[model samples]
Target: MPGWLEVVIRSFVSLVILFTVSKIFIRKSFTQVTYFEFVCGIVIGAILALGSINLQIPIAYPIMGLLIWGFIPYFMGWLSIKSETFRNLAYGRGIPIIKDGKVLEDNMKQQRYSSDELLKQLRSKNVFQVADVEFAVLETSGDISVLLKKDYQPVTPKDMGIKVAPIKEPETVIMDGKILDEPLATIGKNRQWLEMELEKIGVAIENVYLGQVDSYGQLTVDLFDDKLKVPSPQQLPLLLANIKKCQADLEAFALQTNNPTAKAMYEKNADEMMVVLEKVEPYLKQ
Candidate 1:
């Protein structure tokens, strides 16, 4: 074989072996990998490169190096799982860098994390002020986990004791102008329903670039034509408005009626409708 042919064959073999090993043994993302794992990756790539290009070196040597480098990490990972002490040693535990809105300089110094670096990480977390963070920990992955003070944190529905409906994942019924039958079925909707929705918006099936059915069962679509504007689904809002109007009419009737019994019935019905509206407002408004 020509020298170039030999190199190509070696590279192809090395690539297949590397890919197989990676799939079978290595699965962690770069950010999640430990220092030891990172070093092993560099060494493995160097060994493969030398093995592919350097014909003078025995192929068996590189193969042995690859096996050793790959299996040691896998074995260590297994051992780490079985033993807490070994796991902590292999993957260091999270260090508390901030407590009670105060920075722990000693811990930062130990980790060689400077003040500027700490501020930069906090800023990345969307926290500009150190005092706003009630507590913060430096994770083993080098990411900072921050907890904002109660006053500084954004208020949620739970905080206000308001009940909100749980949101479900939206189903993609159409993609690239093609109807996805499986996703349509997953959302408990058929092609006919989707077609009707498209028709309501004056859009054709082929003209739809993407279509998704949200948790509220509202079908939203993106069109291929940028200039064509599609109106949002108003079914929920319209239903809510109609219900409110009925409630108002009942109240008005209660005042207008001369008969005492009829007035009381109208007032009772209006009160009941008001309760129903409050219960469903959260879901419909969303």
Candidate 2:
């Protein structure tokens, strides 16, 4: 084989092999997109490129190098979890940038952040005046986490003495026009119910881009074309929601009450509610 052809073939083959090996060691996360991970990714890419193009370099060396690069940090990550000192050393603790409506110049200097950069971060968080900030911490992820002064903070229901219940994360019912079984099963629902709800809204199953059931059991649907108004039945979601609430109440009551007879009754009633929900699920509006 010609020298040029050998390089070409070797490069292609090496990239594939090295990338496969790298994937075994690397796990991705949102936080991992930070500066450290970005540099780590670039180093791995460079190693793969060198291993692929340079026939002079031993393939085992670059492959091993990639593994070492991956392993050391992984080991450190494990150590960080086990030891607070290691965690603080590897990923420095969040430095206080602002407190009591005053910027901490010393902490900013410690983080090597300039006043301009600090102002930019503050602006990004919608704080124009430093006086408005009660507390701010420069996180290890290079993002500035801020808290506004009590007077500057947005008023909540509690501030006004109004009571409100906590809400759970919204569950996805459908994605890419396909009903999600696992999420539906979570809230005591199934595909049939999803289809029925879609029909009630005059939306074809394929027309929906996404659907979610919120904590209040409200169904929100996003169609492929919003211009095509979907007259989704308000009652269908409401009825299903009521059933879910009833089942939840029964289950909670069963768990809390020590009476075996009452517990059995509650469990049985919850199961019956589930059955009724399934029965009512088939009726879809044309």
Candidate 3:
């Protein structure tokens, strides 16, 4: 083929290839655009532009070039997930829009998001009033996670009349074939304590998938031999009652404390209690 003709042909082929590859990766707009995907799009676009004019190379060379450009973004993304520093660098740090039930105007300015834009996202999520939000975090991907105020939240079954059992967060007994020490220390227990607790339920440490102390000071165990089971309605009431009583006691204690530390801790606990109650409402019976 003639030199000029070959170059033109390569150029046309490059255009077709670039479009096809970009469509494969970029998929949809307004979706979470990861750092890797964004970088891939740019690099592929640039390489295709280069390959179009470089007719001296074989077609195989251009195809290989496209592959390399494509995978660079994918590799970076995989790395980001494995490394916290890389993930932060790729996605950017979360910015706070609201703190302590107040809007941070300075943060909004820094993010270059106006009041209208913030309100638009909020309304899209059906959150109309700013007073309803306690803390709104602007995620790196431009998404917002809102923490709502107590009174503005939905009421739970506990609030209406249903009793709930105390269900504590399951402790990580083993992660990747290793026992976690941090949880052990937090609960003021050790390996010996865990082993004895397991024995009480006729389970071995290896046989137990997860075993932890519930908020009510009861050891809850999940055995590898058994399939998963949801708590009965009867059990839920106990858990709910435990949570409510603890919260009431905490609020009462906070009201009585004069120390700044106690006051701050109490307020923080109150906010968490409100959030939990709101989240569990759907499961509760009025």
Candidate 3 lDDT over residue span 1-286, tens digit each: 8988877888788777777766664444646776557667677777776677776668778778897776666566678779999877877889999887788999999999899989999998889989889889998778899888888778996778765654557556554335788988777778887776655556556665666665434566666656755232244566767777777877887899999899889978977996887677444432
Q: Estimate each model's TM-score.
A: 0.91, 0.69, 0.44
The TM-score obtained by model 1 is: 0.91
The digit string of per-residue lDDT tens for model 1 on 77-120 reads 99999999999988989999999999999999999999999999
Cα deviation at 119, candidate 1, in Å, is 1.7
Report the Cα lDDT for candidate 2: 0.78
Off by over 4 Å in 2: 1-38, 231-286
- Candidates 1 and 3 compared: the better one by TM-score is 1
Per-candidate alpha-carbon RMSD to the true structure: 2.0, 10.7, 15.4
Model 1 ranges with Cα > 4 A deviation? 58-64
For candidate 2, write residues 127-246 as lDDT tens digits.
999999988998888889999999999999789975455668999988998888889889987777777766666777777898998665557788889787655436655666777788
TM-score of 2: 0.69
